[model samples]
Target chain A: MSTKDMSERPTTVLQSLNAAMHRLMAGDSRVVVLGEDILDPYGGAFKVTRGLSTQFPDRVLTTPISEGAIVGLANGLALRGMRPIAEIMFGDFVTLAADQLINHAAKFRWMYNEQVRVPLVVRTPMGGRRGYGPTHSQSLEKHILGVPGLWVAAPHALGDPGSLLEQSVALEDPVVFVESKVCYGRFLTRPAELRAEEIRTARSPFPTLHLTHRGGSPDGVIFCYGGMAPVALEAVERLRDVDGIRVDLVVVAQLSPTPTDHLEALLQRGISEVIAYAEEASSSAGWGAELVATIEEIRASIAPRRSIRHLRIGGAHTPIASSKEMELHDLPSAELVAERLLECF
Target chain B: MKTGERIPLCNRDSSPNELYGLMFGIRTFEQSLLDLFQRGVLAGTTHTCLGQEATAVGVFSALNLELDCAFSNHRGHGHFLAYCGEAELLYLEVMGKPGGVCGGRGGSQHLQHRNLYSNGIQGGIVPVATGIALAEKLKGSGAVSVVFLGDGTLGEGAVYESFNIAALWQLPTLFVIENNGFAQSTPCALEVAGSIRARPEAFGIPTTEIRTTNVETIRNETSRCVDAMRDGAGPRALVLHNYRLGPHSKGDDNRDPAEIRAAWDQEPLKVLRERLDTTEVQLMEAAQTERIGRARERALAAPRYEY
Candidate 1:
């Protein structure tokens, strides 16, 4: 809303995130980065933590390959007056630290009569691109968002990186930072002239703006976030070819408390059917459940012209395997994403 | 029941063995509970840490209160007392009263404090302590975590898992195995198959098996190993081979007194008493009077926990 000072605009999510992370590190001494191979020995498996160790050697620590240990240690550090930014090698490995993350970090303050505080951030990659299926590819943010004491920050665009990320790190509670593996290498436009769209090989998860159809208005809306945003955009493109229907994209940057205000206002503008979050993992507790819950609360207030649908694709209540074939079998592709988007009609 | 003979830690001190004095701390602590139980004052059943105090006190005494965090077992009053002393919140818990720790929702087994934490599950505190130590090591806090488990817990793989992780991370943790020889009447020989201290040593951890009953000797060994760990040397274990002074819990009311008398024959506390021939007569009387007074005060205060 305050774009009067938009002297330089970002065109990619990772670029915006990079600028935001750089700003945060320079601003706070309590903020630090950690995880396996996050240091110069190897600038992290995804480069999300690249160069942080060199810039803040005392703060950026490279831990052993133990997701549970990473989360547990972060919980401890957070309680001990440090805002630790921990990383799991992959989203799949986060299951290993469920005991600490779900049970301790999430419940510490509430369990201890509000005596403990877990001011920490977890940065990990989910979703597949390079054939790292079930085991390596998962957008399991829902698994953690349900836990208490944690606020989920999943920016879908490069814009507002400073506001979204800096506020997340500065919030008094724990924050979950989810990065999609499929989007890590992507680039973006910072300014029309001074854009630095570098090939992101390091393990750094940056931010970029997603201008699917710059400055376009639509009669209908689709609310979504995380790795599925791009897929949803592709599906929207395909859907437009068939009916030329005006489709609005509401790319959410946060997931914990659904943004009902934005969606409601869009729906009020005569949108017939609005599709919400969907992905692999399980239709039970993830976005599917959240969609139904949010819609149920506001359905009575919506006009007769508005409707909501879930573009879900999930599996049984077990961890997905890392096989490419199985992963593809698990998550619905861009074609299916298009099909589901049309189903709202 | 003190015969009033005190032995000094040194030849020149001319006082009671400081080690036995600390055991008396736990012994007196338990005796107070027993008296309260008989007087129908302390409510609910308790798993006394009578015979196991030396191991806990020895190690806990070496801990730096400001930096160290401890995970306690179901039987952890000594731990609570050693760390923060007279945890009134815990008393509220046992009394099944509103003001108790856990708001009385968790009785004796669920004792927990931030500086000192615990859970009701057996060998449960092992992993919890491992996690705490992992936190300390990760934060570079120079703080150490210690968990005291019975030999019975050796059979639980959770302890082994915790040991593997603690040792793997070189976490500053002290694993104290109070081998009082039994797990609720099931002897350790009947349960644990391999060596106990070997569990840590196999992981290249520096373990000390000080099979001593003397509180002072236990303290010396615990302090040495805890010192090494606190200095970030790595996780260490101490196997205090001693005798269980009382039945497992008040539920063991049917326990044969003969069984206790039989175990008392090799009593580590008794062994300690015999080593104090040079104890001064005045200090001996004073130690006895102190023990009795402490026990009486606890008994008269009425069990802070009321059913």
Candidate 2:
């Protein structure tokens, strides 16, 4: 197939992640995959790790239901010169592995004084569209964003998650690769009416994907990431078509390190009047709060005199209910995003 | 010894003098650390392997240091010294000097030198070592991963999880439990329940229990277990029923003075010193004392870790 045909072909986010694993395992002997039920036939809970065990049976380890040990074991493999991608069955279980990730994997290289490098990636699905209830569905990446040596990357459906997964595996530091569960079955194609450009920076390997209307500059900008991209895009379209309000959307792939340089550069490029930080997690102390803090810091230097209107949008503080209606009501939606963006204006 | 030099395996044919020298060196190094702490020359806590020297010296001496990986806990001075014999570098590391093994960043509890690693947390290294063994198994390297845990760490749920995975995967791992009768100040009676051997045995891992301070016996048994692991016999556990001669860290002894005094009779140094000649033992002691003194001087003279 030609490059254009391949790019235009409809691929699900799940397929992209699976292909990323296959490519990584095929190209590098050091790369290994380990998780519960990640073997052939089962392919994990979301099927993102499908066919990996059949392809690389020896390297693809189907571990017991031990979240802490799974991550801890991956840290050991990474320390001993192997590129290991460990899967926590769900993003919520990542709390069980927090000690291994935060204390051991993240602190190993620096604490060991550069005596070792942990090229480890921990992949997990995070989001609440299905009725998986309180424990299984949570956007807990915020808990680990403040870690000194760890990297956090969340790939959206519109971007190439496969390449982002590969990039995360290639990094010298340990990374928490958060995949949105809601985006698994979605097609990995950008909308035709929107123009997308990947903004690259030296600070992070993953690029920030900027999406805007085809012909005109947007009156406001909405910064979202991972699964929130689709919701934000829907909101953007509704704002433009129904209310005649044009708003651009920025989808961030790398959540940690705050992507300050990219956000600063975008704001400096005159895309700053009305902004909204939308996220799938809770609003208090969530990724949106961090981004708002970062934007506030950026605005101090870039536009000290001008008052930039901004709003933070996220899920409610209560535990996500199992009912689909309540779940949708709790989480950020297209209508909510539009209403919040109007508030920003 | 130079960095990355192949460490000689301690076996039956190895000299008693050499083995004694290793155990004695560890004892001396830890004693010097205690002295340094008392003089306010060292910051942070130090877990001395004063009475448990035989386990470290014996277990590390048996493993092929070039390929095998060893994971240790907070009381890891003896293990580090036994694995690499880098007393001077360890001294520098404990003193927070730039010339230390991990550039003075790891301080006393955390250390990494080639295949040997250590951390301060209890029971966390179990899964880490199991994972290393899994890596070695995957690479077909025929190397066994060994982890040292105290009696106190048996209560951690992660240890059991690691035991289950190590047995389920048949990874080449050896879990060495140094049951020094106490976890910090809590006795094993208060912390551990049932038989410790039955724990790993429940996971289908064959275990051997040794209740001696004899370095030779411990070394011989560890070698046997390591050999079984190399031959793909799966994970094994070695329970060393030893005692802690010194306080847990610094001046934190809660045990009876009589118990501590009685345990000194079975200390590795005194036990091994009985086998050697009086003149030879005296000469070895003096040499180790002077060598350790010089290491401390050099470590003190070295500049502090900048960052």
Candidate 3:
């Protein structure tokens, strides 16, 4: 099948990811899956690795509860010419493997003077909504975003997450694939009237998904990604319906290396007058901050005289509460996002 | 005599002259590094395997370089020398010159040559080595992966995690613990509790404990272990009890002078010298000195690694 048809085929975030792994393992013997309880009868905590072990029992490794070892082992495997995808059951547990990821896997390529490539991927379920409490629910991709030689990718439901994951696994450097926990069951569909364009950068292989209205010019632009992409899209629709405000929503898949060139080009084209950066993670020193900084720098360089109103929409600066009401309060809601986007106007 | 009491004479594939030459080469190369550091010719720090040359030489002698791979730790000059005998490249690397093993990016701690890899972080390479073993096993490549660590690394949680996975998965891995009786001057008594062998043994990996600086003994035992691993005996652990003759890095030694002197009596070179022909040892010494001197001159003449 052609790449276009395969991507056009309908798939949920979970199904897309599972099918990608299945396709990768079937086509390439070098690709292997390693994680805790990722085998048959238990397809991992999120079922993203379902049927992998059964189909390729020898290649699929159901590891012990050791996140650090899992990533470290993946690094070794990648070093030895095997493409390994290590799954951290919960994104919060990624902290356990931070040393290996940050120090070893990330630095191997450069530290070894490009003699070796660590084609390893660490995929995990992140974000808060299911009331799994403080530990299980977190958008912690921000912590690993700026690490040199490590690629951080968080594909949204609207884009081809499976293709992004495949691209990530095929890269020579190590990548952290951040899968939003709440978005697993979400279908990868977009409004018929909305137009989607992918913007690629020289530094990164993952493309940024640019979503806009079919004909009407947007009053403002909102940048969001991962689980927050759906929320941002909802906010855009609500703004148009209630306040007659048109907003363009950009779903970024690659979070690291900042995609400065593509973002600079977007700003230069003047996509919208009022711009807002939104994310499910906390606003402090996060994706929102980095994007805002990039936008500000670009705006300052190109159009210093013109004024562009900007605002950052993000989760509350506190631990995500377990209660449904409190969790809703802490997280960014469509109404809250729309209300905040109004401030930019 | 105790395991580490004296160097043992054994009939092995490598002659005594070859073993002594390798050990002497490592010792001189390390001493040159110290000399270069004192003269400000070398920058940054280096962890030399001054007192632990026997383990590197012994374990590497048994390894099939074509099939087996090794992961080394911070103190890895000995292992690097024993595995490939690339003194010129190592010199270029330590000197931060071009054409080094890792293009001078890894410096002294991080090095890669063929199937041998070294890292500065303690206990981090254990899992990496285990992973390599897993890859070899999956590939059906009758190979064994070996990782060298200090007693200090036992404190790291990752080492035990690697042990658990290696044992659980039945990977053909050899975990060699070079217990030099100190964790950068803290001593093993203050850091390690219970027995080191019991740590891996608890994970169902059969453990072998050796307390000697004898390269022949280490080579023979490691050959047995590697042979078994290649034959699918699963993961094995070897606890080699030796002593550190030099400072952990540069002039950081805080141990008593008397104790250092005591360890010198059992140093691998001194012990092995007694078992070899005096004339041959002298010739090997002259040859190593000239070889290393030329490597140093060539490395010094090489250009610095450009960005």
TM-scores vs. true structure, each candidate: 0.74, 0.96, 0.96
The best candidate by TM-score is 2
Residues A224-245, candidate 3: write the lDDT tens digits: 9899988898898889878988
Candidate 2 Cα errors over 4 Å, as ranges: A1-6, A214-217, B1-12
Model 1, position A132: C-alpha lDDT score: 70
C-alpha lDDT of residue B231 in model 3: 88
Local error of candidate 1 at B78, Å? 2.0
TM-score of chain A of 2: 0.96
- Better model by lDDT, 1 or 3? 3
* lDDT measured at residue B90 in model 1 versus the true structure, 0 to 100: 48
Which residue runs does candidate 1 get wrong by more than 4 Å?
A1-27, A150-153, A158-168, A188-221, A252-274, A300-330, B1-50, B95-98, B101-114, B120-143, B149-172, B180-193, B229-235, B242-261, B264-307
lDDT of 2 by residue, A246-288 (tens): 8988999999978888888788767467888899888888888
Of 1 and 3, the candidate ahead on DockQ is 3
Which ranges of candidate 3 are over 4 A from the true structure?
A1-10, B1-12, B305-307
Which pairs in model 3 have colliding backbones?
Answer: B4-B211
